[model samples]
Target chain A: MDSLNSLIDGFGTALTPVNLLWAALGVLLGTAIGVLPGIGPAMAVALLLPVTYGLEPTGAFIMFAGIYYGAMFGGSTTSILLNTPGESAAVVAAMEGHPMAKAGRGPQALAAAAIGHFAGGMIGTVLLVVLAPTVASLAVDIGAPDYFAIMVLAFIAVTSVLGSSRIRGLASLLIGLTIGLVGLDQMTGQQRLTFGSLQLADGVDVVIVAVGLFAIGEALWVAAHLRRSTGEPIPVGRPWLGRDDLRRTWKSWLRGPVIGFPFGAIPAGGAEIPTFLSYVTEKRLSKHREEFGKGAIEGVAGPESAASASAAGTLVSMLTLGLPTTAVAAVMLAAFQQYGIQPGPLLFEREPELVWGLIASLFVGMVLLLALNLPLAPLWAKLLRIPRPYLYAGILFFAAVGAYAVGGEAADLVILLVIGLIGLGMRRYGLPVLPAVIGVILGPAAEQQLRRALQISDGSASGLVDTPFSVTVYGVVLLILAWPLVRKQVTRRMAARR
Target chain B: MTTGTAGPTPGPKRAHWLRDHSELGVSVLLLVLGVLVLTDALTMSVDLTQRGPVGPRTVPLVVGGGLLVIAVLLAADVLRGGRGEAEGGEDIDLAEPADWRTVLLLAGVFLANAVLIGPFGFPVSGALLFWGSAWALGSRHYDRDPLIAAGLSLVTYFVFDSLLGVPLPGGPLMGVV
Candidate 1:
C-alpha cells in the first residue's frame, strides 16, 4: 500500500503537462538519433545528455525514461528492417525479425516487437516498483565488506562473462580502473597517476570518458572503414497484429519479461543472454518450431520483450544498488552523478519524489513509445536513408559539444579525442566496452569500500569475509572464475572420448 | 568471433609470427601502461596522516599488477595465433583495409577543434569539425555542407549556451550574441 500510494503520487508528478512534453521530446530525439545505422541506446543517451543539463533532475530523468525506451525501439526497428542492430542486444531481433522483413512480413514483425516492448516494459516496471523499495531497505543495512564483495563480484562478472576473451575484458577494465585512479585519492588527497599535470589532478570526467569511448571512438572506427554503399531499411506499412498473431504473441510477451528481468538484475546480466534465452525458450515451447529462425513472429516477440524487460531489470540494480550491469546503465549512472544525485539505498529515502516519479515516467514513456512508434514506424525507418558521412559527422559534432559542455574547457575535448583513440584500439582488438565502462564507474567506489572494511578490521583481510553476504558473493565470484576452465576441460574430455 | 585459431600450426608460410600477429601491439601498449601505473604507485608520496590500512597506492598496485599479467597473457595468446576479432557494425566494411587517411584526417580535425576552440570560440571551431569530418567521410556537397555545419554549430551553441546557460566562449562574437 505504501509503494502503491507513492506510485500514484509519482503519476501526479509525471502527468504534468510540462513533464509530459519533455518526455515526448526525449522520445522523439532518442528515436531520431537512435534510428541512425550505427548509433545504439548508449550512444543515443550520451549524445543527448549534454543538452539536458539545463532541466531539473526530475524532468531530466523523466525525459531519459522516454529516451531510453525510444532508443531501444529505434535500435530494434533498424535491426528488424535492415539487419543492422546498433549493438549486440538487437542481434536476436535481427535473427528472426530481419528474416520476416525480407519475407514481406515486415509490418507484422514490427507490430510484434512494438507490442512486445510495451508488454515487457510494463511488466518489468511493475516488478521494479514492487521490488525496488524492499531491495533498497535490505541494502541499507549492508556493510562495507558486503558492498566491497558485491563490487568485486560485479567486476569479475563483467570481465569474465562479456566478450570472447576474458583477458581482453580484464585489460579494458584495468584501463578504466587506472583512469579512475588518476584523480587524487579520496581519503588522503595523494595523486596516484596524475603524472604532475594540474589538469590531470581532478581526473577524467565520466561524461568525457563515456562520450569519448562510445561516441568519438565509434565515429572514428566507422571513419576508418567507411563503406561506399548505404544500407536501407525495408519499407513498411502501418504495424498491426492480427487475431492469430495476437494469440501467438500474448504468451510470449508475458513470458519474455519473466525470463529477462532476473538476468538483467544480476551483475553482468547483459541483454544478449536473456534475449537469446527467450528466443531459445520460445523455440522449445513453440508449435511453430520450424519457424524459429525463419521469420517466426514468436521469435521476434519473445526476444524483443526480453530485451525491453531486461532493460527494466537493469534499473532495479542501478536504482537500488547503484551498480550498472549494462553499458547504457553505466552511462545512466554517470548521468545520475552529473545531476548531483547518488543512486543507492538512500536515494529513495533522500529523493522519494525523483525516484517514484522516474518509475512512473517509465510507465508513461512506454505508453508514449508504443503510441508514437506503431503509427510512425515507417517514418523512423526512413532515418536510415540519411547519408553516412553526415550521420557520423553529426555524432562527432555532438560528442565535442557534449564533452566541452561538461566543463567548458578545451581540455575535456582533448581528453575525449585521446581516450577515443584508445576506444578505437579496443574495438580493433575485440575488447568489449562494457567492462571498461563499469571499471571506470566502480573502481574508486570499490577501493573506498575496501579501505573502509580494512580500517574496521584494523588491517585484517578476514574482515572481507566476516559477513555471510560477503562470503556468499565471494563464493559466486569463485564459481564464475572457475566455470570456464571446468567447461573447457569437460568439452575436451568429451571430444577425446568421441 | 574469429576462427583464425592462433595455435602454432607449424606452417612455414605463417612463420612470421611477429608480423602475422600484429595484435601484439595491444599487449605492448598494455605493458607500457602497466609500467607507468606501477611506477606511479610505487613512487606515490602517501602522507603519514592517512588513516586506512589500504592507502590510495594499494588499489593501483593491484590494478597495475593485473594489467601486467593480462599483458603477458594476451601476448602469449596472440603468439599462439589467437586473434581478437575486430568489432563490426552495419556501416563498417571489415573486408576492406582500414583507411588510415580518413581516420587521421578526422583526428586532425578533432585536434584542430580543440586547439581553435580557445582562440576562435565554439562556433568557428565546431563548424570546422562538422565540415571536416563530413569531407573526410566522403561527403562532397561542399556548397551545402558548410551552411549545414554552420547552422548546426550555431544551433548547438544557442541550445547549450543560450538556452541551457553553459558558458561556451564566444570569441569575437562575445559581445554580439
Candidate 2:
C-alpha cells in the first residue's frame, strides 16, 4: 500500500513537462548514437555524462533511464540492418535478424525487436516495482562478509564466464583493481598506490576509464582493420508487423522476460548468457523450426526481448545492493556516485522521491522509446552510413572533451591516451574488457567490506567464512572458477569415448 | 607443446609457430604488471591510523599477490601451447595484417589534440582534430571537409558553453563565445 502511494507520487514527479522533455530528448539522442557502429550504451552514457552535471539529480537520472532503454532499442536496428552488433548482447539478435533483413523482411524483423524490447522493459519495470523493496530489505540483513563474498562472486563470474580465456580476464581484473587501489584509502586516509603524485591522489575517474576503453580504444582497434567495408546494410522500411507475425511474437516476448530477468537480477548477471539462451530456446520451441536461419520472426522477437529484460534485471542488484554486473551498469553506478546518491536499502527511506521517480521515469522512457523507434528506425539506420573516419574522429573529439571536463586537468587527457593504448592491446589480444571495468568499480567497495568484516572479527581470517550467506557465496565463486575446467575435461572424455 | 618448441619449418609451419607463441607478449605483459604492483605495494609508505588492524596496505598486498599468481599460471599455460582465440563474432578481419599507418595517423591526431587543446582552446583545436581524423580515415574532400569540421566544432563549443554551461576553453574565440 505504501509502495503504491510512492509510485503515484513518482508518476506525478515524472509527468512534469520538463522531465518528460528530458526523457524525449534522451531517447532521441540515444537512438541516434546507438545506431552508429562501434558505439554502445556504455560509451554513449559515458560520453553524455558531462552534459547532465548541471541538472537536478532526479531530472538527470530520468534522462539517463531514457537513454538506457533507448540504446537497447536502437542496438537491434544495427544488428538487423548491418549485421554489426555493437555489444555482445545484440549478437543474438544479429543471428536471425540479419538474415531476416536479407530476405526482405527487414521491416517485420525491426518491428519484432522494437515491440519485444517494449514488452520486456514494461514487464521488467513492474517486477522492479514489486521486487526492489523486498530485495533491498533482505540485502540489509546481509553483513559485511556476505557483501565481500558477493563481490568475489561478481569478480569470478565476470572473469570466467564472459571471456574466452580465464587468464586474460583475471589479468584485466587485476589491472582494474590496481587502478582502483590508487588515491587515499577511505578508512585510514593513507595512499595505497598514488606514487606520491598530487594528481594521482584523487585516483583515476571511472568516466575516463570507460571512455578510454570503449570509445578511444575501439576506434584505434577499428582503425587498424580499416581496409574493407563489411557490407552494405540491408535497407529497411517502416517497422510494421502483420497479424501472423504478432501472433508468433507474443509468446516469445513473454517467455523472454521470464528467462531474462533472473539472469539480470543476479549479482553475476550479464546479457550475453540470457540472450543466447533465449535464442536456443526459441529455436528448439518454434513451430517453424526450418525458418530458424532464414527470417524467422520468433528468432528476433525472443532474444531482443531477453536482452532488454536482462538489462532491466541488472538494475535490481544495482539499486537494492549497490552491485553492478555489466559495463553500462558500472557507468550507471558512477553516475549515482557523481550525484552523491548511494543506492541501497536506506535509499528508499531517505530519498523515496528520487528512487521512485527514477523507476517511474523508466516506464515513461520505455513508452517514449517504443513511440519514437517504431517509425524512426529507418531514419536511425542512416547513422550507419556515417564516414568511418569522421565518426571515430568525432568520438575522439568527444572523448578528449569528456576526459578534460572531469577535473579540468590536462593530466586526465594523458591518462585517457595511456589507458586507450592499453585497451587497444587488450582488444588485439582477445581479452574481454568488461571485467576490468567491473574490477575498477567494485574493487574499492569490496576491499572496504573485507576490512569491515575483519575489524569486527579481530582480524581472524575464519571470520570471513563464518556466515552461511558468505559461505554459500564463496562456494558459488569456487564452482564458477572450477566449472570451465571440469566442463573441458568432461567434453574431452566424451570425445575420447566417441 | 612439442610441435612449437621441437619443430622448425619455413612457410605455413613457421607462421603457425609464430601464431602459437604470439600470446607470449600478453603473458609477459601480465608478469611485468604483476611485478610492478608488488614493487609499488612494497615501497608504499606505511602510516598507522585510528582505524583498526586492517590497514590500507592489506588490500593492495592481496591484489598484488593475486596478480603474481595469475601471471605465473598464464605463462605456464602459454608454454603448454594453450592460446587465446582470435576475436570473432565481429565485423573485424583479424587475418589481415594491421594497417599501422592509419592507426599511427589517428594516434598522432589524438596527441596533437592534447598538445593543441590547451594552447588553441577547444574550437580551433577541435576543428583541426576533426579535419585530421577525416583525412586519416581516407576522406579527402579538402574543401568540404574543413567546412564540416568547423561547423561541428563551433556548434559543439556553443552548445556546451552556452546551453549546458560547461566551461570549454575557446582559444581565440573565447571572448566571442
State the local distance difference test value for candidate 1.
0.86
Clashes of 1: 3
Question: What is the C-alpha DockQ of each candidate?
Answer: 0.75, 0.55
In candidate 1, the residue pairs with backbone N, CA or C atoms under 3 Å apart (3 or more residues apart, or in different chains) clash, namely B6-B80, B6-B81, B6-B82
lDDT comparing candidate 2 with the true structure: 0.82
Counted clashes in each candidate structure: 3, 0
DockQ (C-alpha) of model 2? Answer: 0.55
lDDT of each: 0.86, 0.82
Candidate 2 residue lDDT tens string, A422-457: 888888777778888888878988899999999999
Fnat of candidate 1 is: 0.89
Best by lDDT: 1
Residue A161 Cα positional deviation in candidate 1, in Å, after optimal superposition: 0.7
**Model 1 spans with C-alpha error above 4 angstroms:** A51-53, A489-498, B1-16, B174-177
